[model samples]
Target: MAFSPASYSQNQPVLDALSRCIAACEMCADACLHEDHVKMMVPCIRLDRDCADICRLTAAFIARGSDHAKHVLRECIEICQKCADECGQHQHDHCQQCAAACRACVEACQQYAG
Candidate 1:
């Protein structure tokens, strides 16, 4: 579903953070693919994509005010944390940025999930 921040006014911060995290993860994954030792970045790339997907799903849940949003957000927090850890291990700028974004998302998700 198309996500609009205005439609989910109560969850606006969480949605905004999710959107930023998604963008950062996508960029980081693409950059990882271009790295000289792409093999070493396999985990990072995978986690980046996973985190982005989870964030997207979480946003949708929150937007719809679904009964499962808390459950989905719990999973979202885990994936975002894993992605941040993996990306933080890398020295690349994109990875660093993605890690930061994921961290922000995690905080937002936590607040919303609670």
Candidate 2:
């Protein structure tokens, strides 16, 4: 029983957003580590990691049609928002991109949860 998101009508958007967010967060975190003042990006890096992990878990829950998906989505939204806020504080290209991705994920998750 291979789980395919295509079988779930409304999950595609949320899944797409989550995947994008995960990629963006990972990239941002990696880039932040390379910045000259890595110390300044501690919060952003932490949030990015947390957001990516939660997005991955949320995507899995959604893909499996778990009863707890909604609960997990609520947490995902919170973390995504926090990550976005932290990323938005930075002017780096990756951070800005990550912020946009996180915001998109939040919107998608909210719609899916509704």
Candidate 3:
């Protein structure tokens, strides 16, 4: 597979942030599922799922230069912030990592969206 910088050069920051957030959300969700008290991590798991989905959608919208990118970015910021807040409450390594990634995503989104 040939890599093409021209394919995504325009909105690289948003793309990079989305990719990081998606990976972080997936990792956090998997980690939460492994905890002894799965019930307690349910909120974190749910938020991770939501955040991952939105991040993917946002990236897709941006990649294609869709007219709805603005709307998607708006939603992405909210979800990322909520996910970060939830993850920040936990002391687990995965949660801490996820919180940091989500915060980074928040900053990227703000730059592009606001």
**Who wins the lDDT comparison?**
2
Q: Which 10 consecutive positions of candidate 3 have the poorest summed lDDT?
A: 1-10
Rank the models by lDDT, top first: 2, 1, 3
What is residue 110's positional error in candidate 3, in angstroms? 0.6
Model 3 residue 26 CA deviation (Å) reads 0.2
- For model 2, residues 19-95, the per-residue Cα lDDT tens digits are 99999999999999999999999999999999999999999998998878878889999999999999999999999
- List model 3 lDDT by residue over 1-114, tens digit each: 122347577489879989999999999999999999999999999999999999999988888777788888899999999999999999999999999999999999898774
TM-scores, all candidates, are 0.92, 0.93, 0.92
C-alpha lDDT values of all predictions:
0.92, 0.93, 0.91
Best candidate, TM-score? 2
Please write out the lDDT profile of model 1 over residues 1-114, one tens digit for every residue: 333556567689999999999999999999999999999999999999999999999988988877788888999999999999999999999999999999999999888766
What value of lDDT does candidate 3 attain over all alpha carbons? 0.91
C-alpha RMSD (angstroms) for model 2? 2.8
- What residue runs in model 2 are displaced by over 4 Å at the alpha carbon? 1-7
Estimate the TM-score for candidate 3. Answer: 0.92
Q: Local error of candidate 3 at 78, Å? A: 0.2
Ranking by TM-score: 2, 1, 3
TM-score for candidate 1, residues paired by index: 0.92
User: Cα deviation of 2 in candidate 3 (Å)?
Assistant: 26
Superior by lDDT: candidate 1 or candidate 2: 2
